[model samples]
Target: MQDTASQATRKVRAAGLRPTRQRVALAGLLFAKGDRHLSAEELHEEAVDAGVPVSLATVYNTLHQFTEAGMLRILAVEGSKTYFDTNTSDHHHYFIEGENTVVDIPSGPVTVHNLPEPPEGMEIANVDIVVRLRPKRR
Candidate 1:
C-alpha cells in the first residue's frame, strides 16, 4: 500500500504541480482526513501541529496553486471567508452559520432549474449553491 506522502506526491505530480516539501505536507493534511472543507488558516494550524514548518503565506499560495491545478476546489462562502474543498465533484454545500463551517449537501438532493442565459459573449461556468443553516430558536 502507498503511504500518504507517496500518494500525495503522485497526486501532485499527476496534477502538474511541483510537489514541493511544503505542498506535500499540506496535501497530506488536506487529503488524509478524506473529503472535507478547510480554510488556509485552519490548514496552517494543522501544518504547525504536524511540525511541517511552513509559513501561513506558503499555505495560502499552495492552496491557490492546488486549486488552479485542479487538485482542489475553492468554496467562497462569504466575502471574508474562503474554504478549500477536497471533493471536486459536482455537489453543493451547507454552510453552518454560527459555527462557520461547511458540509456537503450531496449532489442529487438539490437541482437547479431555469438558469438564465449568460450575457453575450460570456458563458455560465457551473453554479455553486450554499444553503445556509443555523440552529432553530425556540
Candidate 2:
C-alpha cells in the first residue's frame, strides 16, 4: 500500500504544485479523510492536533494555492465565513445557519434557469447556490 506522504506528493505534482514539506503535510491532512469542507482556522487546528507545526497564515496560503490549482473549491458563505470543499464537481450546498456548516446538495435536484449574459469579453465561470437553513420555530 502507498504511504500517505507519497500519495500526497503525487497529488501535489499532478496539480502542478511542488510538494514542499508544508504543502505535503497540509495535503495529507486535507485529503486523508476524503471529501469534506473546512475553513482555514479549522484546518490550522487540525494541523496542530496532528503535530504538523504550521502557522495559520501558512494554512491559508496553502489552501488558496490548492484552490487555484483546481484541487479544491472555495465556498464563501455570509460575509465572513469561507469553507474549502474537496469535491470540485458541479453541485450546490446547504448552509446550516446556527451550526455554521455546509452540506452538499446533490446536483440532480437543483436546476439552474436562465442567467443574464456576461458583459463583453467576459464569460460565466460557474454559479454557486447556497440554501440557508435555520432551526424551526418553536
Task: Give me the candidate number with maximum lDDT.
Answer: 2
User: In candidate 1, what are the lDDT values of residues 67-136, reduced to their tens digit?
Assistant: 9999899999978899999999988999999899999996687888999999999998779999999999
- State the displacement of the C-alpha of residue 122, model 1, in Å, after optimal TM-score superposition: 2.1
Colliding pairs, model 1: none
Angstrom error of the Cα, residue 61, model 1: value is: 0.5
Weakest 10 consecutive residues of candidate 2 by summed lDDT: 1-10
**44 Cα displacement, candidate 1 (Å):** 0.2
Cα lDDT listed for each candidate? 0.92, 0.94
* Best by the TM-score measure: 2
